[model samples]
Target: MPTATIAEDDDGIRLDRWFQRHTKDISFNIVSRWSKSGVVRLDGAKAGPGDRIAAGQTLTWPEELPVPVATRPTEKPREPLSEAQIEYMRAMVLHMDAHAIVINKPPGLATQGGTKQPTSVDAMLDALQFDAPSRPRLVHRLDKDTSGVLLLARNAKAAAFFSKEFAGREARKSYWALTVGVPKIAAGTIDAPIGKQPGTGGEKMQVDTEAGLKAKTRYRVIERAAGRAAWVEFLPLTGRTHQIRVHAAAIGHSLVGDGKYGGKESYLTGGISRKLHLHSRRLVIATPGGGTLDVKAELPPHMAESWQMLGFDLQLGDIEIVEPPPPPLKKRRLSSATSGNRRGERRSRGATDEPKRPPRKK
Candidate 1:
């Protein structure tokens, strides 16, 4: 019999369910057929279709069934980094201590490997021998299009520490975005609860009060441009998936170039730019040595151009603070006439103008 052992990642699922999860292209009917045929067994005994399984359970299946493929090994031949890539990495590596190395990852480079892509930031860091061991470990991740500071821990211990710090919200992260419109208030907080949309291919987040997680984002408008756009700063208090992007879009002003959240007009045409305008401008953390660690990333090429077009100079120091435009006009509450006819019904019921004539028909 072809024997297989359940992995830690497969804990808390059923035997038949585990098969379905592992075999991507296969259907549940196939899994049931295989189980009924005795091709699949658990712990040298026949496994029922409904049997709940724990981790480390051994499973046996016929060799005729194709083996689930493993995660593609990180080791693969890659062309040497281009001159530009090398320079990018060089600029990103702000501080390298014995415990950790930090990098300002550029936009468009993925942090981890996926099915289609062979190389990733981790692979590149390994190739560069940034860590003593053959493999360098990623402590955290940034979105594929997000250009910002990323942390790498040289050892597993350091990785665990940094991971805890992030989970505990001990690290401070600040992002700068050029949004399509200015917020009505100069500074305010968004405390909307966020929940993932169902059946939307995992691409949308909605503000839901009933079944959503607590999400808060503190934002302040830094500068506004003739009602065209505004520069804003964001500090997310919670790290739900796509929290910043979704929250910004929920408030009506999507970030420039954010095609996922922004409407059609928010997209930029040719010769303008193709990248998202959000940037992880700064990160502050407490070091193991009790010293405050602060790092900042300069604006990438696309944002730099956008800033220049808005009449801003890049030679200025970090954290450019600009004067904001006037606040947007607040939406007016509708009068009773426009709101609805509820009051009209009440007024008509109370009127006594010659209504006694109707009693004769009764």
Candidate 2:
């Protein structure tokens, strides 16, 4: 019998996974039979495959199959990357340190992959590791066509640190966008909630202030182009799917190229290209060592072209950045009569991942 001991990091992980981790040569059927036959024992007692384990537990294997040859590899093979892709990633590095890497990600490149998207920045992330011991891990994500600053933690420890900052909204993110029309107020907060569109197969998102997830953004109009378009800066207080876009539309000034929410009529035809005119302009966040990281990305080519065409200043001036709004309070379900009357009830903002809606079908 070959006995193994579980460690602290493996606590709460499944038992079958333990076998997959330590006994890679053991087949699925063997694990199932051993688990059923009381041959694979835990703490001198029988254990099931789905049992959640804790640290300091001992596992005993039967002598019959007895770990077999144990020749097969445990870790899955990484997808191969071409040299071109590797160089492309290196050129995008905006900031690099021992713990993290920041990239000025370009428009049309997805931060992660999907069923339809085979190749993405995430798929190619292995190439981005310069000399780090491990592949850089994405700490945050930007929408595929919404280009700008994105952060990657160089190691597991750094990943946990950055992940906490975002989860707590201690990180500040600001965006620049060109909207179809000027908002009635030059500077104010748009506190509309967001959710997936009802009939759009969850492909599109809209401002559903009534029953939607809590979402908020603050905006200040930098300049307006004679009732045609307005250059605006936004600080999203909560990460929600299509949050800034939905909030802009809620205020009747959707982003110029956001046809999904605002319709094709929102985009200007002649010279300005109908691309999503939003950019993740800057990020101000804390580093692992009690220091701060302030990073800014320049406007992408299409946005720069639109800026020149609209006579919008390339210099955005000293824009005010504010702290994210306090998290929304949880709402208790109210009676129908009270629900309509209690308009002041608070809503909750729940976003497990950076809230970019899944890509729409082509």
Candidate 3:
């Protein structure tokens, strides 16, 4: 991100107004959201959109922040979205409607921004608004480097509706990845619990079996390259952070190039790129109003390149889907009649007694 130093002439400008004046694409709504979401910082502290700026104050924001509200652009012609960027965003759309939008997001793009994150999908939502008044909101997240289908809610109604589905565990999301080693089993369920790793300043996670939230993932090895690596498909039953990656690592088949959990072996030799080899391949869920939303994303560039290099088939995960776990059984009590007994009778004395202690032997 680049830093903007407030000049003496532009002192006392509201953060929101500054964006409106300088940037052609950064709307007031985007400014407001960015401020409230902690993506805007003033002198290393979270800033509000209404905050006033003075001379020498430094404002840091995502490098991709749309055109300037700075003094240099107040009298200049408006800058339009570059043709290349417009085309890139247009090509990522898999499906779009009044209620939602499904996009095949690329790798290395953060779903949400943080202190060091200068650009992210959330920051670029303005390009997708089209006829809508407000920007589409993210329903869920994929990891920063894990590319593939990302769902967004186009309006507030859609946002609430999809959020409920995600909360209720209704979204059937499937992911594909290349892992370092082959699993002994071809397919299985991982029922371990996971939670934030202790004392890593809240930056990492672990298999906290002792006191962790429940997380389960069902995986099937779609294709394997012997012991060198395996291409696995995952259906996670829970929404814990880094659940799939951590579970795969715990099972001794860490994803290739995933160092946070995969360790040193994540880096492979022989011309394979050292990038996280995970992609959210598909999503099946109910739409906000009353229909189904099924979308699939193709392999991202790096993964596709790796697929070609390793001789792995890229079309194997086209229709990947897994059945949800069955519901738990209910307990029932038996009545006296059901137990082969009269209502008021007990077992016979002889039947209830030992066999006379074997005639007092020994």
Each model's lDDT comes to 0.69, 0.77, 0.77
TM-score, each model?
Answer: 0.63, 0.72, 0.67
Off by over 4 Å in 3: 1-84, 319-362
Tens digit per residue, CA lDDT, model 2, 257-291: 88877897778976998899999999999998789
RMSD of 3: 17.3
Q: CA shift at 123, candidate 1, in angstroms?
A: 2.5
**C-alpha displacement of 77 in model 3, angstroms?**
19
Q: Give candidate 2 misplaced runs (Cα > 4 Å).
A: 1-76, 322-362
Q: Cα lDDT for residue 227, model 3?
A: 78
RMSD vs true structure, all candidates: 16.3, 9.8, 17.3
Task: Tell me the tens digit of each residue's lDDT in model 3 across 1-362.
Answer: 76788764345667776666666677778767878788888888888878877668888877776535444454634245566766777789999988888999999888998898957787777788788765688989998999999999886557767888999999999998999977666666677788888888767888887888998887777777767988888889899999999888877788998999987889999989899999999999999568999999999988998888888766565543334453344532344321433111122211321111112346
Candidate 1 lDDT, 185-260, residue by residue in tens: 5455677788988888766887777898988886666666767777777888788878888878877788888888
Q: List residue ranges in candidate 1 displaced over 4 A.
A: 1-91, 268-272, 313-362
Q: Choose 1 or 2, whichever is better by lDDT.
A: 2
- TM value for model 2: 0.72
Candidate 2 structure lDDT? 0.77
How many clashing residue pairs appear in each of the predictions shown?
A: 0, 0, 5
